[model samples]
Every structure is written in C-alpha cells, then in structure tokens.
Target: MDLLRVRAARPAATGAVLAAAALLAGPAAVAQGDSTTQSDSTSPGTTQAGSGWNDDAYRGEVEVIPGDDETADMVSGVVFEDADRSSTHDDGEKGVAGVQVSNGRDVVTTDSEGRYELPLEDGMDVFVTQPRGYQVPVDEDNVAQFAYTHMPQGSPELEYGGLEPTGPAPEALNFPLEKDMGAKHPHQSCVIGGDVQTYDEDEVEYARAGAFSDLAARKDYSSCGALFIGDVVGDDLALYDSVRELSGMLNGPARFLPGNHDLDFDAESREHSVDTFRAQLGPQYYSYDVGKLHVVALNSIEYPVGDGYNGALGERQLEWLRRDIAEVPEGRAIVLATHIPLLDFADQGSDVHQVDEVAEIYEILEGREVITVGGHTHSIENLRAGDSLTGWEETFGVEELPFTHLTAGAISGDWFSGEMLEEGYPTAIQRDGGVPGVITLEARGEHLTERFTARGDDGSTQMSLGLNTPAYRDWFAAHEDDAGEAPEFESPLEVPQEDLGEAWLTANFWMGGTGSTVEVSLDGGEPVEAERTQQMQGEGQRVGAEHSDPTAVQQQLVHGGSIADRSMHLWRLDLPEDLASGTHSAEVTATDVHGDEFTDTVEFEVID
Candidate 1:
C-alpha cells in the first residue's frame, strides 16, 4: 500500500561474489576546512550537502517470482501500483498501464492491464524503467530494486563467487512501484561518484573519511540518487561488505557500477566475467527515468580474452542501446552512464580506454540532446561538445564530440595514494592534479549543469591556486627520478625578482573546460585572462613538468602518488618582473561555461 515494497524473494549476493557500494564523501576531519580561504562559490546552493540525511527512510525487499523450469521461452510480469502501501499485490491493488518492461534486448510497454510478456533467455535481466510520476522501491541500504537477473546454471567458478545456480526462469516477475508526489517537479540533483576502488579496510576507512563523508553529509540527491561510475574495489572483490556499509551511510539512494577492477578474473568467458559483480550489485546495464531525463547505464567493457578488457559494447548491447533510445521521446535529454568514457581528455590517444564504437554511439542518437559521464581514468575532466582529439579521429573515426562528455573522477583518487590529511583520507591527487571527489549533475527538466566537490572541502574550493617558479621546475627536473623520497620543493610560493618574470600563477580548476574562463588579478587590481594550457581543439596531449599543476606536483613528488604531469582544466599566466619587491596577493576567478563563478586568493612574496 505504501508503494510496491517487495517482500518476494529476490537475487541474493553470495559472500564470495563481488559486492559493492557507490561512493561520495566529505572530510571527517577536513584539512581543507581549516585553510585560510575565502570565496564566492559557483555552486548553485550555498552548501552542497545539507544537514538532513534521512537515516530512517523506508526500505523494501526485492522480489523474484518462483518458477520451476529453465526452458521457458517467455516471462510474464505485472507493473502494479501499490496504492495500499502493502508492498504486495493485494486484492485492491490496480495495475499501472503503459509501463515499459525489457528483458535486456526487446522493450515492451504494458497494456491497459499493466502487464507484459517478453521472450526470456539465460543471462538476461528483466527490469522495469520507472516512469515519470512513479517511484521504484529501495532496499535496506537504499539501493533501488527494480530488476531481476536470470542466470539458470549461474556462472563458472570465479575467483569471487559468481551468481549461484538459479535453477530455472521464473514464470512471472512482477515489479512493484509507488507514486512519488515530488515526481511532478522536473528539477533534480544527481550525483555521479566515479571510482571508489578500495583495496583494503584502511582504504575503505579512507573512502569513509573522504568521499562518503561528503556524500552522507549531502541531502540534495535524495530523489535522482547517486550512481557510482565503477571500479568498486581494487582487485579484491572480497571487500564488498565493507563498501556496502559505507554506502548505507549515504543520505540518499545509491547505485554501483562495474569497472576494470571489479571483474571476476577466474571467469571462463567474457559475459561471465561480471556475473559476480552483477550478483553482488544489480544489473550489468539498465535504464531508468528521473524527471524529464532518461538515464542509460552501459556495460562498455568487453573482455574478449582472459583478463584483457577494452572499452567496447557487444552487438547485443549496442542493439539494445538503439532500441533503448528509440523508446524515449525527442523532448527529453539522454544521459549515458558508463564506467569507461565514450571518449576522454585523459586517454584521448589510447584506443583501449576510450569507447571503441564512439562514432556509432554518436550516430545512434543523432538529433537528441545527449550527455555522457564516466569513470576509469581517475581524473576530473569536463570535455564539452565540439571538442575534438586527433587520436579520437585516428583511433575511432570520431572527428569531434556530438555532445558533452564529463569524466567523473574517482572518490578513491590516485588509488587512495598520498599523505593522509587530518580528515583521515589521503590527498590522493589525481593525474590531472584534481583531488578525490564526486561530480554533481543538477538538472532542471532537460537542461543540465555540474560541479565537483573535492573530499574534505566545500564548493568554493573548486580550483587550487598557486605560483610555479623556475626553481620549482628545476627541482622537478632534478627530482624527476625520485618520488616520495624527494626533498620538499622549499618556499614554493616565494619568488625571486630575477625569476618573477619566469614565474607563473596557475589555477587548477577541477571542472573548468573549453567554454570555461580563468582570470587573475594582483592585489585586487583589474583581472587579466589566464591562458588555458591545453586547448581541447583537436590537439594532442601536452605533457611534462611545464604543463603540470605545480601545487599538486609538489605534494605528489614530496609524498607518494601519480604525477599531475598534464591537465585539460589548468590555466596559467606569467607574472611581470616589477620594479618594487614586497609580499603580494593574487586573486583568481574561474567561471564555468554556465556562467557560474568561484573566486579564490593566493599569497606570494618577491624578494630582491
């Protein structure tokens, strides 16, 4: 009666299967919170996370109808409106007509009676796409329940326990739903947490202290919920329970994904590789609607050979994508969610990491408004429409992006590597010098905008402002061979008058892209435009110390982690060799394409 709360038996994840949790967090003991920083955040809200996290929200059990045979040709199901809040189809529950149901390939809408039948095959998922004004039920951990996986003989013995042998396909798979009063409103906040990728318990705690803290503290994404892009764990699928516990602390519903790290290494074939992940999490790929948007989760990783994975969708999945897009009306925007990017700034030249059939994907939704977000590279990237890469053209025959492609950097930044902050998480600076965080996609009807909240910090801290001197670059060249054990780049913010002309002020804007602007002002003087280092205009990647974020590299070289050798969002401006020498302050303002702006300040000294 309170919505279709499933009491029926559903898929159970085994202790040995790969289990997971979507992650977004804040600093439990934030070092950034203590910094002497002031700002006017580009953030839509004054604070990203509200104080209210509904720990006592409703929970429902998932259901999978019982059946006796594995040879059934078709499966039947009802999309009932649980008006009685009984969680079951009681005598009074009425069927909701016109709902869409799919068995992975073919999509069918329910008749006037709210029931539909589809051809069934082994290794397929039968799910209901929650229609506008209707809400799906969530489980104890706030993971939405709307699909049933059918794997009769289950998986071959995997390193992590694969799905247990589901003896037969069920005769009927009824999907329960409740009407959401708030669904009438077309605005929503959706969180995309990239790679959690926890390796062990300590890293799990690091995740808690970092991204999950940030996520749990936020009340904004309760309706659209949070979808973790992938890389749920680092090789150890055994850490699922620990991660799930962290997900339980989230303020809203949570969804997990599969990445290269979440594979079943011992599986016998390509399709079976992620059976353990699906068993622990939900479907491999599925779709759902929130407000005016239709979100498609894709399993883009193709493992043709043992343990060797590439970013490509199989024919079956691609065909499904075509069928999936056809169902949506032209008025709504489509958000494609995958673990590996359709194409990315981080791996623009690499064929394996970027989606192989990107041009085909672009062709599928030729005229529709499409936005893609993904994880895997572990860096923050905000590549926009018309952004082209020579490698994209050479490798995938894609000349330019048809729509925006946002890379949601990992919650477990740099594999959770680097010095621990006071919040109990590592600085974990990424290859792009962006810190660990989650990307929030705010949507009002079909229009979309996004922002990144770094672990242990607020919205105003979007960019890291600093000065890069010639001495630091020289030290970088000298210590290039020695990381973690290298001597600290001393007095990095101080400048010599002779080197002032060679010094540059840099802003590592985490979410800034081609349409974004970064301006600098000295001692509150008039602002001057700072040049973007690597313009996303069909150019090859510009790498090395000169292109790096000096602030992030200083921490990485002195501590331990991947070097932030290059970036797509970094902007720089050379300082003048002035006549006077004194302590000086520079203010930086970063304005995103949407015209939202954040201003931050950094202080430096010039000695004669």
Candidate 2:
C-alpha cells in the first residue's frame, strides 16, 4: 500500500475530571508537521531527534523492538466537552463532533458522538488536534495535555530514563476540551521567537532583559500567542525551568518546540532520546487551529547521525504529516514552525542544515498558501515564493520555493555572545546583521504581513546605517579578535576623498528581502538606489568586505560574535567621487515589500 493510504477504524471516547480555571484573555495556545512511506516495521533510516553532550558508553547502541500482532493493539479515545469545567465525561456531558484525532500516522475525525479510534502500536504517541473555539486542558506547569504516549514494554535499556512501561492501553483514553467563547478575530497576531538557547542562568537573564521583557510588555498577540521555536536550552535540560520562567512573562499563551540542544544524546535508542523533553514539554509535534490559521510545529532534528545531527523528518513524522494535511480543507493558509529550517538563504551550501525531505514536504503541501518559520540558524531571512538557493536546487531538486519561508532570528542572538550593553544585555548581533528580536506575523484571514521587532528597541528601529569605507574595512580586519576592548573608530563621519570613490553607504534592513528596496540621498538630494548584495535566487554566497554591513561587522568583529560578512538583507551604494571636500550628510531609507519605510541618517566630512 502507498504511504498515503494508512487508516484505522474509529474508537470510543474516554474522560477525566478536573477543576476548570477562569476564562483567559489573549492569544490562543501554541500549536505545533512532515514525508516517508507507511511501514509496519521501524525504518532503519529513521533516526531520533534531540542532542546532548556525547558520552563514550552510549556509542553504537541500536534501537531494539519486539515484534507483535498489530491487530492485538488498538487505542480508543473520545473527544468530549468537559461540562462544569470537570475533565470527566459525566452523564450529561456530550461529545464534540468532527474533532480530528491521530495516533501519529492515521488521522480520523470524531463522529457526532465525539468518539474516535485508531490503531495503536508500541512507542506511538496519541494526540488530539485542538479545534477552534475550544481550549485543551493544561497541566500544573501550563503544558497542554492533548497527547498520551503508549509504550507497552517501555524503552530498551538506555541512559536518561525513557518512557516507563505503559502496562496496557487504558480502557478509556479521553481528551477533554473546554468551550472557549472568546470571539475569533479576523486579524490575529502571532509572535515568533527563535533559539532562546539559554546555556546558564546569566544567559537566561540576558533573554529576560532582551526579547522576553519586550514580549512581556506587549498584549497584542492575545489570540495566536507566542511560540519559541527550538534551541530552548543549550544542552542543559535542567534550565528548562528558567526558560519557562522567561515564557511566563508573555501576556498570551506560550508554547515551545524542542531544539537540538534540548535532547538527551546518551539515550541508547532514538525512541528514548527525547524522554526528558517530553517530560518537560508536552509533545514533540502537534497542531492547533486559531481563527483562520492552522499552525503546525514540527521536530526537525535528527540526532547522533554519524555522531552529529541533520535536518530531516523521519518515516513516522512524514506519514503523520501526509495524513494530517489530508484532513485540512483546501486553500486554508498553513503555518509551519520547526527548529531546523526546511530551506534557508543562510547555510545554502550545507545540505545537513536543511530538511532531507524538502521536495516531499513541498509535495504534501502543494497548492496551498503556506509559510514556514524556523529557528536554529540564529539569523533572520524572509525568503519568498519562487526563491531559489543552490543547496536546495542541487540537493533536493527543489527548483524554487512554493511559498514564503522565513527564518526567525534568535532571542539569544549569537548565543549571547557580544559586548554587554548599557540596557543590561549584550549586543549579540546575528550573522545577517539582524539584532536579537522576535518576528511577528499579522494575518487578516490568509493574508500575512511580517514584522521584526528588535530587542530593547521600538518597531521603528528596522534598519542599521553604516559607511563602508576602506578605513572601516581595514578596522574590521585588524580588530577581528579584540572583543569588548577595541577602540571605537573615531570621526567615522569623516572620509578622505581618496576613500570616497571606493567607499559606499550600507543599510542592513533586518526584514528586507527579495522585493524590498534601499536608497541613499546626499544632502537631501535625489535618492540613489542601492543594490542588494545577495539576491537569493539560486546563487552562491556573497561574502567578505565588499558585501559586509560595516556597522554590524565592526561591532561583531570587535565584540566577539559571528562576523557580518554575508547577508540576505544588506544593500549598498557607492559614493560618487565628484563631491567636493566638505561636510556631507547622507539619508538612507529602506522600503520593504509591505510599502513600509524606515529611515536613518549619517553625516561625514569629505576631507581633502
């Protein structure tokens, strides 16, 4: 049978009882996708996700499973309304019809009685797709309880405790949802933060002062809430509490997806690797509907692949995705959130950094209004439809992107690596010259307009201005290793006439990409259009002094961080040699595809 045809019979409904909290205001909770064929046996190629510090004793251990009759194992569940706010299905409580439920691979909608059944196998995760107008029950830690794992025999011997033997399938595995009467708005705001990646308490505090604090102050995204996509911790699962404390600052629901660093590398089998993550976070992958948006978050890391990791969706996830998407109505806009990028402008030459099943994933999502947002790269990118990159083209035969793909820049920019700022944080600029920030997707129905909000700054701070003079380039090259102690380049506004011909004005518009424009004006004169360095249309990377953002390069090279040698949003304009020796002021304006303009000015002396 083709992988797409897997289906299971419907099952009965189950329930539990719990006290209901008051109706909450703000955005809906975090929603959390895949490629591969259907198979009864575990595929050898399907590696586990999550990574941690390597230990010699955990090397070369293979995942072992005992074969059993598929017909003997069946999972039955009910999707019911917990009337009186109790999670249990009492005499008067009724089932909710048409609710989709899944045992990972097979997707079935609840009948009028709000009951669904699916084939359950060992080591399978069963979950319900949160429908619009209802809220899933939350645990004490506020983690959603929409999923249940069934492992009859438990995980094989391994380090880092795996799922304990589930004994047998509960006679009634019920999922409870409370009716949420909050009006769904036509316009919804979704906050996206990437790679909080806090390594210790200090970095967690840095995040607190930076992006998290900014999020704490905003109340706009009460519907879609805030989603932190991957790298939640830097290989230190113990700090999950600290990360959760940061999320606690948000006004809306906060949800998370596990990153590479959030794994247990010592587990003997891939099935056991994410035990800690599952114990902390609710589910590895799940989906939810809010307003008109159908959001899907995926686990994109394949750990310990030759002692490292790669971006992929193994057989299980892929099959689940195919089935899941099948239930989605045609033409509904889909948003995918993942840890590793499906495709990105950055790391275009590295195949390992992108999903191995890009083509298949696209095929599954064909003819849909889709946009993918990912973290892990720690850089910002706004790749649009038809965008092409050499790595994607050559590696996956993906000629062009079918829709938008944006890389959400990290909250812990450059791993919290940079000079301490007066604002009580670091100036940890990203490789693409984007400062630490959160990305916002404002949608009216299926139409979305993206906006990036830099940490510790207002929305107006969308671009950076720098004079890319020969002197500045020289300064960048000389102080490559001297972070925090490098002397500031004085009189940066003054430039010798000899340096003018070779010098240029640079603007790094953090969210600018394919359809955006940057123009420079001297002395309030005509604005001369500057050229974008990286067109991102199936080309190799453009790097070095000729294509760098002098402002970010200076700070990164001097203050310890990834060099701003290449960018997808950098624009440059050469200064004319005809200008006489005197003071000159240049005004730069960056206009994004949304017709929004951000302006900045720089003044320099044309020294004789």
TM-score of each: 0.91, 0.85
lDDT of 2 by residue, 1-608 (tens): 00011123112111100000000000110000000111121111111123111110111110122334434577776788876655666677888999898887889999999988888887777888878776675544334567877777776654545567766666667788776533154456788999999889999999998888887666566446678889989988888887777765655566788888988888755666676777667578878776667788898988768788889878889998888888887645688899999988787767788898888898898877788999999899988777787777778788888888899999998888877876777878788877888998766666667888778754555666667888877876777667556666655556799887898877787899788898888888999999998888788788887888767766666567887788989998888998889977776777776666666665567898
* lDDT values, one for every candidate: 0.77, 0.72
Question: Candidate 1 at 400: error in angstroms?
Answer: 1.4
Error of 1 at 29 (Å): 20
Estimate, for each residue in 1-608, the C-alpha lDDT of model 1 and write its tens digit.
00011122212111100000011121111111122322322223212443443543445544567898757879997888876555676676888898888888999999998889999988888888888777777776777788888888878778788888776877678888887644435677788999999999999999988888877767677667789888998889988778888888876667877888888877767778788788877888888888777889999888855448899888888988999889998778788999999999888888889888887888898888778999999899998888887888888888888788999998999998877666687778899988888888777778777777777664546777667788888998998777788887777777889997788988888899878898888887889999999998888999988898887787788778888899999999899877258877776777887776676666677887
Provide the lowest-lDDT 10-residue window in model 2.
17-26
User: Over 4 Å off in model 2, which ranges?
Assistant: 1-72, 152-165, 181-183, 481-487
Provide the lDDT at 483 for model 1.
73
Top candidate on lDDT is 1
